[model samples]
Target: MNAPPRIAAPTHAPEAPRLRPDRAEAGALTRLALPIIMARIGLTLMLVADNMIVGHFGAGPLAAFALGLMLVQTSQMLGLGLLMGSAVEMAAAFGRDALDEVGRIWRRALAYALAIGFAGAALSQAAPTIFLALGQEAALAASAGEIAALFGWSLPPVLVYVASIGLLEATGRPYVGVALLIAANLVNLGLGLLLGHGGLGLPALGAFGVTLATLIARITLAGGALAYILLLMPGRQALGRPRWSDHRWADGRRQRRIGYAEGLSLGIESGAFASMTLFAGWAGALQLAAYTISINLNMLMFMVAVGIGGAAAVRVSQARGRGDPAAMARSAATALLLYTGVMLVVGIAFLALPGVFAGFYTGEADLLAVTTPVVAGIGFLSLIDGAQRVVANILRGYGDTWLPTASHLFAYVAVMVPAGYLLALGLALGAGGLILAIALASVLATGLLLARLVQLKNRRS
Candidate 1:
């Protein structure tokens, strides 16, 4: 990967625009964040639909689906993160008005996606063994393994298209993905209802049915995104054209350098969450129930941060390419301010109406009692956690990768996991202990990334 060029600031600081709050800047930030946020929400809904469909079958099937999907998603996260580097690269390239270079990045990303996707497929086939090793019930493991193997095979299309989605986003047509993912969700729901419950004289496929439905939906979205790029987007043919003289082989390593760090960062961060989920099991059934519901909501809200962060990424990449230090500063500041302000509102709502959110998930008084504090506390967690996600993306936009990745590993795997065990198990705080660990990790990560952003700003001048 190339070293990012520093933003050369004028000797006179007063000549540049001040980085402060303004209505026009805030409006621009909202517009940029909204579509990306919509895309994230759509993707979240797709998973929610799968979970909902499987849930109708019974607790056992739901457990299998949950375990199986997590296994698949673990690998997906790695591959997806690796491919994500292309988006940042392409966005910067676009900022420089080098359309052909953007195309080359996308082509290489698709190739990487295929290679990684196949490996994921192989892992899916062995997920049952993993489940057994993790001490899951034999029957549950078997069911989950079957579903994972089949759905896992779809990774090639799923990931290849994800790279495509990134390219489209970098090219400034971000809404296309939003439309396709939402449509895909609808397709998944219809097929899930049919395949899982059985219809038209077909037998019920149970968990496998939902997996199959998800696969088909993925294919449709992937196909749709590709078609839009090739047929409708401007300068489509310039994309994917190889330079015969240049060694395409060597660039793959550069792409890996670019993306692998982000992927590893995500894996470690997610691993911390996974470890807590496991810890919850040790806490007991009631605590586990509370942990799962509250955590899921946390994740959902985190997506909002992701959306805001994604917008920052696009803006920052473009700023880098155009060599606009002031623009870069404004983009980052506006995104941070916007995200924090919105999250504070969400946090306040959670504080005031924690029971209201929990009631939507379950009616059991015990479950509600356990969930309320977690929900209330989540408002603050969301503020930091969401900020951490954005800060990571912002750094990625500046072509800074591994440092942030290391920060996540240190904060999450190093800090959060051990803290959860000590606090939850050692202190007997149960689910509350795990939540506190998450909050600590998020706060640490957010602080470090923000400091890095500041350094980058100072360097620009």
Candidate 2:
């Protein structure tokens, strides 16, 4: 009886072990990344489709399209960079349980978006002048300028869509943006054909027609994204209604500061590539078309990194909001890991099937000959280019901005530009030389970013 009583001493079960933070972050990052990746890919597809349509029109139109894109895309990146702060700030707010701040941040971002869009539109109107000033052939400059003007008006809608998507992504509603992008692409394709080829009693717009189609599709996308944010998103409840009262100067300043650095960084990088495009142009219309196609394909792959980097940004921002440095480190590491694996597969495919990939964009035998090798160059370029993108975004998440911007300036402007000139012109490497220059710059930028991230981690520790 005594032994039984002793055995009856209270025994409590051990509590379930807590889930590892890194593992939880891995799951969250994956869930967040997949849809964003799809959305990013969808965004790239818009350009791909536009290029293919323009390519079929003729090499001259294709060259003009590429030239127009040099301005349009650089401005687009600048706008996106400025708005990127919305996602970081809102995600941080959500992580720290400051839910109300999320909505306010978005409102401020929207205002900035509209202002930036209008400014970009005005800037785009001068593309022809800019091209001529940059030594582009007069005829080519005029054609490209026309295309640029048509594409320029699309900026407001594009920026609005970007800002809205940022809100949706941070709030765990990324799928909506992906769906909207899908719809936008469909609209673009249908209209692009009708306008581009002049069908259904509609006058063929040529390159301008295709560009106008993009403009219309962008407007549709923006409207849909904004509507969802206002009417359907559950997170909108937390984000609150669009209220003017929410506009506070201090808050807007903080958000804009983030954008300033990122915008400048993106401007530098995009401008550098645009300079390379100019180099290709000097090589001839064929080289320009080849460079354009190769870069677009590489950009498609780069979007994979952007998607993962986006998820990492949210995760790191949230961790920062929670004042947890370790979590931030882990989240970044996880993102890099995912990007590495995905890019590895993509790189291998590019190397193995460069010809097939090149075929999809153009039917010209000469164009394919130039494009295929450049596509293969993308195999190695993707890894370094994508790594830099991910690391830069991670640093942005931590609010460490200007340094990254400086690094980009040095790498792209200082290193890549001259290297591109030397390799493409002096060495007479043409399109392939341009690719090599880009790869070199990307490697430098990636290393700088990684070291910066490591420094931040060590300081935190």
Give the candidate number with the greatest lDDT.
Answer: 2
lDDT of 1 by residue, 37-84 (tens): 888778777677676566555445655666677677777878878887
lDDT of 2 by residue, 208-238 (tens): 9999999999999999998988887774677
lDDT of each: 0.80, 0.86
Best by TM-score: 2
- Clashing pairs for predicted structure model 2, backbone only: none
Lowest lDDT sum, 10 consecutive residues, model 1, at 13-22
Q: Where is model 1 more than 4 Å wrong at Cα?
A: 1-19, 55-60, 95-100, 137-140, 231-234, 240-247, 282-289, 317-327, 359-373, 426-430, 458-461
lDDT of 1: 0.80
The C-alpha RMSD in Å for every predicted model, in order, reads 6.4, 5.8
C-alpha positional error of residue 93 in candidate 1 after TM-score superposition, expressed in Å: 3.9
